[model samples]
Target: MLLPLRRALLLGLATVLGQIVWMRLATGQVAWVQVAILVGVTAALGTVFALNFTIGHLRAAREEVKRLGVNEERVRVARDMHDILGHSLSTMTVQLGLTRRILETSGDAALAAGRIAELEATARTALSDVRATVSGYRALSLDSELAGARMALSAGGVRVELPAATDAVRPELREVFGYVVREAVTNVLRHSDAELCTVRLGPAWVEVTDNGSAAGGAEAGNGLTGLAERLAAVSGTLEHGPVPGGGFRVAARGPTAALDPAPSKEGEPI
Candidate 1:
């Protein structure tokens, strides 16, 4: 391929030769009027070429922006669905197992029926959440997720210690923290054999700790990965690993700010 500068020089030389040949053939001499006409034609062709180049660049840029928007929406939908289905299915599995155990040990139809009802409610809520996610209208509530964590943990036969209220958490941080709590509790139920699970909340942080070792099941999964992304969107960080001696802990910490002057008290056992 010719270098750009060489190509332009060659084209200019060719155009000069072609114009000289034309002038000699048409009038046997160059005239200012003919020269002006040639210049005008060349200028018009150059303007057309520039306009076409510019239009092509603009079209390419528009397509790139459209592709990026589609990819972003896909990521959002996948994350929301992962959060919804992971927790709901995990809760149902635990609840179904509990109902089976209750039926086997005591033959209590009423108790089993009650557990089934709870499972149905959870399923219905999950369906609603999925719909909301698809419509791009879903916003998680810290309070609701905490209630869900309590129910799910209890069904899994794990003792839970949770804050009496989430009022201490900053308003802007609550949604991401809600995601943190949901993902953390789901992991504890599916991956741990803990006897006690505790959730601590503060103005800029939330932590979920379980007394059960993960038995090497502490690797980050879809839930944790999505949770980390959600936290990162809010300038927050996610930390998860085995505790000093045993068990596992997952925490999301946001930027340090004086959102609360007085710190929250310790969570009470429920």
Candidate 2:
């Protein structure tokens, strides 16, 4: 393309400048000294031109790196926001709807008031989490996400069967798995009509299964896409699809970093 032409033009210009210097310094006839001077001048000019090109290229490369870094940060923020706000808003909607129904059927002011208070607390916590995520200070834990998933599923009227502990999962993968749990549960709440949701944990994998009829036909949305990317960053894999007969399953498996020699069943779904 144009690169070789540019290089040729630079070299040609440098040679022409060198020839002019040689002519000005010529003593009417060429000699060995003059030839040597011409060669030296041309080499010097070529070096100068080459250095200029190199510096220009280096500057461009630096700018490209900076731009790429900014883009990466932007992507990270967008994904985190989607995960945070999406789940929070969904939860709030479900809670409000459920509260309204309870009030309509039972006419229990005290119960409705208590549920409203809990919803308020959830909103506050979600706000705090959003702030933390924006400030790059948010840290997700498997245990906390498990608890949140259980609460969210139950609130959505899905009977949850969640692991009692996270001791079997690898420490480094806990955060990623936490994200998986959050997104998976959120999917169940928002997209399914499952009555039973079960979460199973192993040394290097976590699976969320629900008896939702829509499992086979569910499309891959932004949540699942981003979750897959996040897991891939740490050599982890995400598998999500309909089960053999009549359920949806989302599973995340990380590189084996188990604490136990064999997979333990200590954190089986309760």
Clashes of each: 0, 0
Pairs in clash, predicted candidate 2: none
Off by over 4 Å in 1: 1-44, 257-270
State in Å the error of residue 171, model 2.
Answer: 1.5
Q: Model 2: per-residue lDDT, tens digit, 7-48?
A: 766876686666666766875544656567767775677678
Model 1 per-residue lDDT tens digits across residues 1-270: 123445755775587678878888988997767666766776577667667777999999999999999999999999999989999999999999999999999999999999999999999999999999999999999999999999999999999999999988889999999998898888889889999998888788888888886654478778888888888888888888877667888877787633433222222222
Which ten contiguous residues of candidate 2 have the minimum total lDDT? 259-268
- What TM-score fits each model? 0.81, 0.84
Residue pair clashes in candidate 1: none
